[model samples]
Target chain A: MTYCVGVSLDAGLVLTSDSRTNAGIDNVSTYSKMYQCETTPDRFLVILSAGNLATTQAVIQQVKRDVHEGKPRNINNMAYLADVADYLGEILVNLIRKHNEQGGFIADATLVLGGQIKGREPNLYMIYPQGNYITSSSETPYLQIGESKYGKPVLDRFITRDASLEDAAICSLISMDSTMKSNASVGPPIEVLIYKRDQFTTPKHYKFDAEDPYLLAIRQEWAHHLNQAFRSMPRLEESQAQPNSYLRAL
Target chain B: MTYCVGVSLDAGLVLTSDSRTNAGIDNVSTYSKMYQCETTPDRFLVILSAGNLATTQAVIQQVKRDVHEGKPRNINNMAYLADVADYLGEILVNLIRKHNEQGGFIADATLVLGGQIKGREPNLYMIYPQGNYITSSSETPYLQIGESKYGKPVLDRFITRDASLEDAAICSLISMDSTMKSNASVGPPIEVLIYKRDQFTTPKHYKFDAEDPYLLAIRQEWAHHLNQAFRSMPRLEESQAQPNSYLRAL
Candidate 1:
């Protein structure tokens, strides 16, 4: 299982992914799942992937090969970010079909394609295993895949298109930390990238290992605040605490 | 889908559940999933259920009928909480088999049983549809059923066998709140019951509707504290934010 999130904010885009991969509990390993595509100076793109590792690696290799061979329809040649998502979705769909047709194993993967393309607005899209895709809307400025639920409450509470780039980056980590706490299938080293819209340059990337002090600090702080907040919840109204009420209900 | 949790602490036990049930989105309805059994004053028992609504309701009805008819193996006749868990598990497995043998649907419902049987310690057990049961330990003092992941991180952070009854109740509500925020399948009016050790009395019961002022206040307070906590995270070191780093990473 995997957990990845892509946030599209007015300031830029924040993308994050967990690195733990397991075939079985005994066969766990670490692999970087974040890849920044080398697009022309006018466009910027990064992909965060989750699902079958073989399928994802194949998709990434095919992407590199297309660019190396200068395939006419490569991501580097796409004029819009949505076009890039479409191209990636095609690669994913074909790979899945090819593997399924072989009948020995299942092949499926989901990817988040997010970035800015020239004069267009920065955006985010989650390409599904079926080759369809969905972009973040004004109502919900983020997208997630894989083991997503544990990390979602925080994102639902804080993420928005109006959020600043730094705030989005921080919120993504909190989301990741919450996930790592709840699910062993998802773990560190956590990789994060912050892409500033329109610049089309290299985004800031930070890799935090399991023992990273910054990650620990933020986790402890959040726990402290949560406990304090829990303590402050309006006390269960005294009237609601009546004893022996069970007898009456029965 | 449903979301229900039970917490056992040195101070007592806390059980909370959401009331929303649905066969489909268009058919959504509210139905209480919490049941407090009629037992002798020396004992107290509560069950929180999730999964196939029909199966759960049937199990509830069976327990009710057994007690009303003075069946030899009814809950009121059990001497140990573990024995009660075993009894409940048998009923669940037999009910499921009886339904599935007819061959039209999957008969499944998982339950969290928590309370005290006089002279025994307070306890919590999650009875599986397959007739197996698991109990909370000192290390992790809570059990959850249904849409559980979104609500687990909070319990993992705050619950312990030594926690106070009030703290456990507050923490359970927070878990319910988080689950409701991330998944539409789970909703309110939320129901919570707090059982103090040895009292064998009616534990307090509170139900909060969608617009309950207390629920609204806690949700708002939690959001405000979370945002503040996000802001206070250690800043991303400027040295890590180098430009054109993408070119080298490729």
Candidate 2:
């Protein structure tokens, strides 16, 4: 199980991934799921993967090996963010095909690649196990893969295109906190990477442990605030009930 | 699809269920997933169902019919909350078996039963498709079935046995709101039932629609507070960066 979230905001793009992988509860291991491909100073890419570790590692290896051997493939040439997404999908499919030819080791591994080249705006994409992918647009503005449900509500309630990079980062962390609480398979030492728009040279990254003071404080405060919020909300009582047919059905 | 959450607080029990059923995106309908069985002053049992509408309805019908006929069953003699849960599970299994024996039907509905008997404190149990169930305790004071993830974070962050009834009710609503945002299958027209401790005769029931002014305000206020909270948190700067071995590997 993994929890990885990438948000594309007006200021920049924010990416966060957890490092806990478990074949079973007893077989837990720490494995970093975020990979960066920065062959040039101007072009940058971040890949957050979830599902079968072997399949994702194999796919990453294949792409790196291709880039290593200087193979003049379609993805090797200069392309925009969308082209990079397509190339990543094609590479995943080809890798899966190669693995299948040799008795596939992993049947399920999906990847999410998001970043920008020097010329265009930042973008985010979620790739399926079938090697198909979809990019986030203005309306969506965010993409999350792996154990997404626990964290989705916060994103839906808070995230917007005009949101600041700092706010996006906080939302991703809050989202990760949600996943970590409900799910045992996902644990801490989370990796958060941020890239300012048009600045492809360096990306901001942070690794948060479970005991981080601020993180712990935020979780506790959020819980307290939530209870307070609920109590403050007006409670509908039986006395206020009007003689309505719908109220009778309740 | 449905989203139902039941919490056991020191004050009493809180249960909320959405009223949306969909075979697919096109074939969506409105159906109540909550069932109440009370011998009045003796026992108060509420069952929330999720999964295939037909299967859930059949299970509920079988249980209700058995009670109506005054059968000499497990629940007939023992009018307790735990006995009620057992009776409900048995009816579910019998209905599933009968349906399966007649023809192949997917009987994969889950039930969350919570209430207080005359002799015991409030108890919450999650009934599985196999008719087996797990009870909620101090450590796990809440039980949720069907589309449970989106709403899980709020519960994990806020729910506690010491929480007041008002707080529990608010938590349940917030959890439902989260589920509805992430999953279109579980939508509004929410049903909330609050059972105060030792007050089995009087249960507070409220139905909230998507356009409910208070609910809308809660959602809006929550979103606003979240953004404000995130902005107040400090951002990590490049100078504060320590050694990140994970990034070194990349």
Candidate 3:
């Protein structure tokens, strides 16, 4: 299992991914799910991937190989980031179809493609297994794939495109922390890459191992504050009734 | 789509459910998912249900009919709450199979059954559609059904066996609020039932409609605190590097 989230803030874009992949409880492995795709000064692109490891790896390899071989439609020369997303989706769906046809196995994967092209604003797109993709909306400026539910409430409450890059990065870690606490299949060495809206050089990337200081501090801080917050949450105004007995259903 | 959670604290049990049911986005309806089995001063059982509404209603109707007709294995006669959970699971699986054999549609549902019998300690069990059930453990003393993931993080953070009944009820509401925020399908009126330990009479039930004042109060309070908590969370100490330049992946 995997948990990857990409948030597009007005200041920048932040993408986060967990490293744990498991076929079953006993068959767990760690692999980086974040890839920098053909970055240069004017244009920068990064991909956060989830789902079948083989399919995602294959898609990444194809992208790199396409760039190396100077394919006509490689990420290097795409006019817009969405076109790169569409290219990635096509490669992914074709590979999935090949695997399904050959072995009757499902080889599905999803990707988050985001970055800036020289003239366009920084944007994010979530590619589906069906060779289609969607960008984040202004209201919900974050896109999540794989193990999303555990962390969605955090993003729903905190993520806004107008927020700062630092705030988005911190919130993504908190979201990852919440997901890791509730699910064993998604574990650490978390990776976060932040891209400033227009400075299209190598994006800021931070990798947090299981015992990273910032990770541990925020985890403890979040948990402690959550407990305190729960205490401060509103209490019910019990109606006048007999004490020490269960009040009848009303 | 539904969200129902049952928390078994040392103080007793608290069960909560939303009243929204939908076949699709266009065919949504309101229906209560909480049901009370035949209860006496000595025994109490409440069920929070999820899944196919028809199947759940059938299971509830069968339980009522069996108790009404004086069945040997009815809730009123069961010595242990686990026995009642098992009985409910049996009726559910049988009805599902009958429906499948007749029309070939999947009639699956899940239930959280919690309360106490005179001779047994207070217990909670989650009955699956396959006719098997599992109870809460000492470490994780809550079971949830239908659209459970959005609400699990709060339960994971705050629910413990030693929690006060008031704490448990408030935490459950926060969990529900999180779910409703993320999912339009899981809406109000929210129903909550609190069962104090060793008190087997009708449990204290509170219903919060969309505009309920206390509900509005906690929702606003929680959102405000969450924003405050995020600001207080740790910030990264970025290394000395070129200003406005993306940091390289490390």
What's the DockQ for every one of the candidates? 0.56, 0.39, 0.48
lDDT values for all models: 0.87, 0.78, 0.87
Worst 10 residues of 3 chain A by lDDT: A240-249
Q: Give me the overall lDDT of model 1.
A: 0.87
Ordered from best to worst lDDT, the candidate numbers read 3, 1, 2
Candidate 1 runs further than 4 Å off: A242-244, A247-250, B242-244, B247-250
TM-score of chain A of each: 0.95, 0.90, 0.94
- lDDT per residue (tens digit) for residues B1-250 in model 3: 9999998987899999999999989999988898877555689888888999889988888888787888887778878888898999999899999999998998899999998988779999999999999999999899999999999999998888999988888899999999999999999989888888888875788888899888899899999988889999988777512243332232
Specify the CAPRI tier of model 1: medium
Give a tens-digit lDDT track for model 2, residues B1-250: 8889999888888888999998889999988787776454676777789987778887766666666788777344566666777777777788778778888875677899887878788889998878888899898899988888888877877788998877777778878877787888998888888888888666777777889876787677766666555565556566534354235332
State residue B171's C-alpha deviation in candidate 1, in Å.
Answer: 0.9
Question: How do these models rank on DockQ, best leading?
Answer: 1, 3, 2
Give Cα distance to truth, residue B145, candidate 3, Å: 0.4
- Write one digit per residue (lDDT tens) for candidate 1, span B1-250: 8999998888889999999999989999888898888778889999999988888888888888888999999899888899889998998998999889897677799999998988999999999999899999999899999999999988989888888888788788888989999899999988889888888876888888999887788788877877777777777786755354562233
Q: Candidate 1 has what TM-score?
A: 0.95
The local distance difference test score of model 2 is 0.78
Candidates' interface RMSDs, in order?
3.1, 4.0, 5.1
Candidates 1 and 3, the one with greater lDDT: 3
True contacts kept of each: 0.57, 0.30, 0.50
Q: What is the lDDT for A238 in model 3?
A: 77
User: Model 1 has how many clashing residue pairs?
Assistant: 0
